[model samples]
Target: MTKRIQHWLAMLVTTFMLTLSVSAVASNETSANSDNERLGESVVRQEITGFAGADYWRMVKDGQEGYTTSKSPEHGVLISVPGQTWYILKEKWMSPLGALAIFGSLAMVALAYVVVGPLKLSKPKTGRKIKRWSRFDRALHWSMAFTFLTLAFSGLTLVYGKHFIKPVVPTEVWGWIIYAAKQYHNYMGPIFGILLVAVLVKWWRKSLFTMVDIKWFMKMGGMVGKHKGTHPSAGFSNGGEKAIFWLLIFFGIAITISGLVLDFPIFDQTRRDMELSNLLHMFSALILICGFIFHIYIGLFGMEAALDGMITGEVDETWAKEHHDLWYNEVKDLPENQPGYDAAQEADKKGSASQNNA
Candidate 1:
């Protein structure tokens, strides 16, 4: 009986102690929560940053959306990196500017048919004239000129081939053609570079922009043909032509250099660097093509008398007298410029005289 009583008492004492211990633990936990509310969370932010790397942190104080990263005891300073968007521009129901440039170019070409009639002249001049270019000079000019034309057409086909022309070309063949076009385009790029250098060397003297050029620029070269007065009187080339020429020179070099970087992989270039080159090359080409389109116009339908300058190296007598008075005067001084002279210069005069007299 004594032993049983002793065992019961010991079990009762052990149960009471365990109950007190558990209650104390619960009370401590509750107190910790209360303390947390008062202490306002020990953010204790730790920041980690490095060169060319993201900023990292623990318990960083940050703002939402545009306003990010604030400073607090718990949160540390935060930095931001910019983000880009991928939205497409819309025009006439939404279109890219590239499509616009293309569409506008086509429209201009079509309009040429309406604006420029058969190569007929208005008022013919029977007077003597000057000689501007020789047969050799013309040969060089036409070679590069035709080369550029071929390259432009092929290049356009390559640039907009898939979007505009793929519907007509068979899929398999189109793929092959595009591949071939790219190959040829790149191959001929160096050729263009060579031609561009030659042209620069050939015309650098005449192409220099002078203070006189400022007057020309302000007057828009006085080339107001569609309106009232006639095109501006010019020497060898006009201000606008000079601008286009210089652009071609700079952009030609740029196109060549960037193209080479991509073609040869000469530098241990990074992918980003390569991507930049591609963008720059395309941008430069786009600008050149835009200028070139106008050049083609002025060379062809836009002007009544300028086309022969490149094709046959001479213009009608009256055409020269009217548009290129200064140049005509210079050539008139040259014995080679005398009419019935039997030279190409004289032959050009005869051809132009026929047209001008019409």
Candidate 2:
């Protein structure tokens, strides 16, 4: 019985050792097969994908059509060279140029104010007033003024708010502010356009250039040195006023047209048209802004009693005589000092002489 038990134990031990060796060999072969399959798959992937540099992007940029559900023709374009070029111009060039133009005008005005001082009246106020602007005139002036300023502020916020305002304000507040500015600008643009046309039409006759304007230009409207005491003869509008009017007419028209192009996209205008219009709108507005800086300065503080004309629809007789002698001559008798109105007498004599000659 002992010998039979020993023989069975030996057989079982040998069988167990053989089984372990066979399993090890099978495991090694399986691992090697897996590695070979992995290598093959990698090679196939490389062959299918081609090179991963310029060729890849080149295919994408060569007017490749992308899948989309939209029926619009432009929707399928994967890349647009014109659009990319416009983006670069707006970001890298237009934005910076606009900033410089605006700030440069401000600095120039400031320097002039410091060096030249206010253009003061050489004579004393007579305490008498003559009508300078009519009620309709004052209404139109103020309407245009306020509307233009609103547009300017909101438009500037759109352009520069991200760079200057975003860092200083809370993110939530900044987002709201920008959103509000855009809304204000979009709504007010058409209003400004209407008012501008009115202003140009109403002031056209008075703003016509004449030979007398040449002399006013030579004297710099008596705003320069040694000429400060010399009150150059001027009509209803001086040479400077004519220049401002023309600037407003041209630039204002350009701004209005371009703004309309952007405001209403229903005209089926192309992306290229919109891009060009935006460029024209922004740059034209920048130029107009420079002119506005001068206009605001003169109307508010640069010239004494200037705002009075626009605010009250009248000016003092002395103020009129100093700034606009020719216009004063026409309306001099309309003031309170009319009892001794010698201007009307002089005008009658001149009129009689001209009539006789005719």
Which candidate leads the pack in TM-score? 2
Local accuracy by lDDT, each model: 0.67, 0.88
Ten-residue stretch with the least lDDT total in model 1: 81-90
lDDT of 1 by residue, 179-245 (tens): 8888888788778878888888888999887765676666665554452244456777777878988
Put down candidate 2 lDDT per residue, 50-142, tens digits, no spaces.
544556557668766667898765677778778888988888999998899899999988987998877888888987778788889999988
C-alpha RMSD for every candidate: 15.6, 10.1
Q: Candidate 2: lDDT over CA atoms? A: 0.88
Best candidate according to lDDT: 2
In candidate 1, position 70 carries an lDDT of 53
Q: Candidate 2 clash total?
A: 0
Off by over 4 Å in 2: 1-59, 62-73, 334-358
Residue 289 lDDT, candidate 1, scale 0-100:
74
